[model samples]
Target: MALMITDECINCDVCEPECPNNAISQGAEIYEIDPNKCTECVGHYDEPQCQQVCPVDCIPLNPDRVESKDQLMDKFLKLTAQKS
Candidate 1:
């Protein structure tokens, strides 16, 4: 599943840089995660980097964008291909 930044986000700016997919961005109110770009760091790390760095613990799996590990890996491969 993709990750989401809830209203609990403090916007301390730590999570943005930690996202390998660059999915985290400053929204009108709080940081937002683009489900299309979010792979939950499946190909890049053992855990979601943003969630690890977020001080407020606002980052959570997005229920609306749930996916299996294989699906996430597929998304990661697609994103990786696009970069090249």
Candidate 2:
């Protein structure tokens, strides 16, 4: 599953830098995770980095979107496909 930033986010700008996929970005107020680019840190790290660094514990599974390991891998590939 992808991760979602809840309203509880402190806007402290902590989680943004931790995302290995660069999926997290600064939204109007809080950080926002782009589900299309999120792979739960599958190919880059042993675990999700945003979840590791979020101070308020506002990062959680995105209930609206769930994917299997292979599916996540596919997404990861797509995300990095354009990297130069």
Q: Which candidate achieves the best TM-score against the true structure?
A: 1
Per-prediction RMSD in angstroms? 0.5, 1.0
The sequence of per-residue lDDT tens digits that candidate 2 reaches over residues 1-84 is 898999999898888888878889999988899998899999898889888987789999999989988899998888888784
Point out where model 2 deviates above 4 Å: none
Q: 1-84 in candidate 1: lDDT tens per residue?
A: 998989998889999998889998899998999999999999999999998998889998999998999999999999999999
Estimate candidate 2's alpha-carbon lDDT, on a 0 to 1 scale: 0.89
Q: Which has the greatest lDDT?
A: 1
Ten contiguous residues with the weakest lDDT in model 2: 75-84
Q: Backbone clashes per model, in order?
A: 0, 0
